[model samples]
Target: MKKDPSIMKENMKWTLAMDEVFIQALLDQHYKGFRMDGTFTQTAYNNIINELKEKLGIEFTKSHLKNRLKTLKEHFKESYDFFRNGKLSGFSWNPFTKTWCAEPEVWEQLLQEKPEAIRWKTKVINH
Candidate 1:
């Protein structure tokens, strides 16, 4: 069966500014006790959505925010693991470039096993 185009949702693209605003809004709501047991309440999500719309002039749904949060968490976990794991020792984070710095040989071996990690050489996650 063919799907209805009008009813389908398009992928949401979040800009860095939008993510910053979203995180700020989430933090604000968290301080207000909207987060409990490591999960955001519905009110918190609503507040974040409203804040994003007000600040960025863009409409965002709870699913979009949740998905973005998941992606952010995944990236954070990967960075944390890469640094914390003893196998990847001798690497330092470059605050100036916001990227991880290490010997060429170190990166070469890592990239062989995890090619997707190449993004960290260029892109930095601010959060």
Candidate 2:
């Protein structure tokens, strides 16, 4: 039996969407490297994006995803701080430390978030 190319394309679309909805751990590893504790500033992020674009033979980046997620994080942080500490600093710090002290949870969260960011920047969000 043969399949239509259009049908195959449509199926692929749904498959990719589902993949993005769920987290991909392998890609998540890429995000972990961008961890903020001691690596990856904004400039560095841009450089990484450039390299990825070259490798992927396409355009777009995790920076776009970061912008959107940053918005979500900022709002949540403000709400949390308002209730917990009555303040939300605009600045964000990597919660991780050398020994799982300050930001262990943060590091875990990054594993999820970074992959989402890459997907969003490359696929979901448009320029």
Candidate 3:
């Protein structure tokens, strides 16, 4: 299959330090029960920015945060597995909750693999 240019662009922009931080924040929110419906709220962006500053001691600009979120939403859309009829899907956005959500099994699989850095933070999430 041919590669998607947009996916390539987003993939190239992802830095381990920043992207991993975003992923971990989402996982943290998941454990907090804030995403019972698999939907992660817009508040996650603020949480990520705060955590990044606290842990990395670097300030993350709002523009960068907004860009990351835009890329993430595109990722969620592309990651979905569609059926031949284009009906079956993996994730869908919830406008009311301002979140992206997927079926439990798909969500589990998406999160099962962890970045090495975030893996250690599981302890923090547990507490």
Residue 59, candidate 2: C-alpha displacement in angstroms: 7.3
lDDT string, candidate 2, 8-114, tens digits: 33122223333242223224444666446644456556654565445543343454435534554574554344324322222133234211112345434543645
- Model 1 per-residue lDDT tens digits across residues 34-122: 99999999999998988887888877778888888888888888887766643466677777777787888988887888888787766
Q: Whole-model Cα lDDT per candidate?
A: 0.80, 0.39, 0.55
The residue-level lDDT of candidate 1 at 45 comes to 97
Flag regions of model 1 displaced more than 4 Å: 1-10, 85-87, 112-116
Clash pairs of candidate 3? none
Residue 114 of model 3: what lDDT? 30
lDDT of candidate 1?
A: 0.80
Q: How do the residues 1-127 of candidate 3 rate in per-residue lDDT, one tens digit apiece?
A: 9864554342335466767776787688768765656565567657766888797665665456657767766544443322212343564555455444556675555456533222222222111
Model 1 clashing residue pairs (backbone): none
Q: Give, for candidate 3, the lowest lDDT window spanning 10 residues.
A: 118-127
In model 3, what is the error at residue 48, expressed in angstroms? 2.2
Cα deviation in Å at residue 110, candidate 3? 24
Q: What ranges in model 2 sit over 4 Å off?
A: 1-27, 30-32, 38-60, 85-127
Best by lDDT: 1
Best candidate, TM-score: 1
Model 3 TM-score is: 0.40
